[model samples]
Target: MGASARMRLQLQPPAIMAEVERLLAGRTRDIRLKGELRRLFQERSWPRTAKIIRAWMTWVIMLDALTLGLNAVLLPRAIALSMILPACILPPAALASAFVWTKPRAFWLQRLSITGGMFFILMSVALVGVGAGGEFYERHLNIMLFVATTAIIIFAVPLRWTLTVAAMALGLYLFFQLHNPRLETGSAVAATLFFASGIIATVVARRTMNILAQKTFLLELRDRSRVAELADANARLERLARTDPLTGIANRRWMMETLHRLWSDGMKGRDAAMLMCDIDDFKSLNDRLGHAEGDRCLVKVAGIIQSSVRRNRDHVARYGGEEFLVVLPGADEREAAHIAERIRQGVEAASLPNPASRVAPYVTLSIGVAAQAPDDAIASPEQLQHRADAALYLAKQAGRNRVVLHRPDPPGS
Candidate 1:
């Protein structure tokens, strides 16, 4: 064939170029999937990884441009001008730059471009051997190309895929070298050195991946533990807020909220009742028996009151140091007074030592009862409380240890 015809034949794509493109496309897909997996595990942020990949791509483009420029400079003007090799290469570098700068999802396309560029460059070198008998690889050039390719592959792809592609490319390059045997001993040694360097990089990358995986697992475990501890603490706080510390009954806050909810649900009917009771002469009792005995008496009285009001909706709470409140959602005023009387009787029956006894020789309670129909003209919860408190004041005035009912105002007496 004539020299010009032969040169045109060298510029056309070879069968191997299609295979290189397919492999690179698959590698790009694997790299994208691996990155998504890392993000799913929260091991690395996607934006950060993308920035790093782009920066690495920029460096790779720089290195490849340097290699091509050097190769162009070293070639004789006649030889360099005779081939379309340089033009074939510039497009891939330009695509890679655009991919980096424009931030497109062209990972596969960019990779395919690079693979085609390498295959085309190798073919050019191979076709040149048909006419001229010069060394196909210069030591410095092979070393630079190998370094640049290895860096790009390791940074842009998963470890296994990177190693696989590197192995295939190296094998093909070695096969070409075996056919032409024109490489100087120094060039062969440099190839070997570059090959050794690739092995070292593979080892380092694998180690880094293992460390990243371990760190991710430990951080996930730590976060789970912290969440569990916080949930447990919240449960304990809820329990404390709802329970009376001294009596083990529902606290006033919990009882008030429950009563308001029940009242809103139409529980404040004529059958529902509330009772407020207090230990008679509790301050004198504390003075005579000391606060310790007073506390014991209060505890004992709370237990008795809770026991007397033993229905599911019958709630008792220590209203204050020496007073208690009870809510009965389905009991009349008389039944509620009876229940309070039972509590007073239970305290009297205990007959434990009471040095503060003025009348009963032990602690006694005066209770007040109030009832309301669902249609009653009650303005607020405080009004109900005020009526009960007024009844309790009257019970105390009528002498201790008695129950009093709230008196309605007479109309136009």
Candidate 2:
């Protein structure tokens, strides 16, 4: 095949995978789910892998030391000691690598330390194998050690690092075999079989771990999305509960709670006020103009009351049919009266024609203003509301289209 054609064939798989990734990313927005998946995998798996690698390294180092001590009796003192010295340094370095693994960002350093340590340990054992003898016993023992160490490295470390350590150990093994002419063909074949088995084991273990990690990432993303959707649903429910469906103002439940809060503040030395407003002769207006116009009238009055009370702490609610309650948190009697007068005038100015009966030709409001001083002895939200209602009755009785201040009942009357 031509070089260009060969190159295109080689590039096709990666190009197809890239296109698939792009399509998935476009569907999922700019969040880079694949990148997040990888990050989550690292975060979740790295610590456990580090711990396993550390434990395996410790065991291997100790075993190497013990083996060196045993071989010392059979081999030359110089050769055995040469092996023992390098083996002695490995366990401490392995333990230090465990410490490095505890740092989240030091994963690469930890991997490097672990892979490098395994490479050196295998290389040191290979050195001993070369120097000891060219006999069958020595070759067999070294081959077993190489196979065992390869298995440990592959099983303990992640895929990329395992491949690296395996490559280095295999290279060192080949180098040793090349230098030793006395090594038999059968032993070489056996060593090749062992390396192949380790490679297969590594591939199987790594693939299994990657599959599990991907499943975990997908499950976590689904759970996060569900939680977010639940939170939004709850917020919408809360808004619906607090708002009046007809006029779109605060509902009675929200207004009562707000009034109780204001009462608490009033007890703590802040004056507050309440304005209980009713549409002037609303029943006749509803009967004459139809309930639809009545509903529109309520919505318009609610808007006017909401707009008239400019203070952020002031709250307005549809108290009941044809009635609204305004709570001003810090307003005293004079300020309360002024706000109520403004609401009354605002309703009159709207000039919604009420051609039925006694009030004005246009729609009007009778607002009852009730102010509470910090020291006033009104002990309950009911009492406060009652005082405003009483004033509202007086405003209706004294003719509509005006604000009336609450006058508390005379003592013991």
By TM-score, the best candidate is: 2
Please list the C-alpha lDDT of all candidates, in the order they appear: 0.61, 0.70
TM-score to native of every candidate shown:
0.48, 0.67
TM-score of 1: 0.48
What lDDT score is found at residue 267 in candidate 1?
Answer: 57
Query: Model 2 Cα RMSD, Å?
Result: 9.9
lDDT of 1 by residue, 31-56 (tens): 22233233333323334445655565
lDDT of 2 by residue, 1-413 (tens): 34553333233334444543454445332323344345444655665676676666667667767787787888777766655655565566556665666656565676777667666666655665565554733573455456545544345445566677666766666566655677676776677667767666766666565555555444554444456568789999998999999999999999877766766755532576788999988999999999999999999999999999965778899999999998877689999999999999899999997898597788999988888755577536676678888899999999988899998667899
Q: What would you estimate as the lDDT of candidate 2?
A: 0.70
Candidate 2: misplaced stretches above 4 Å? 1-77, 80-168, 174-182, 258-270, 310-312, 349-358
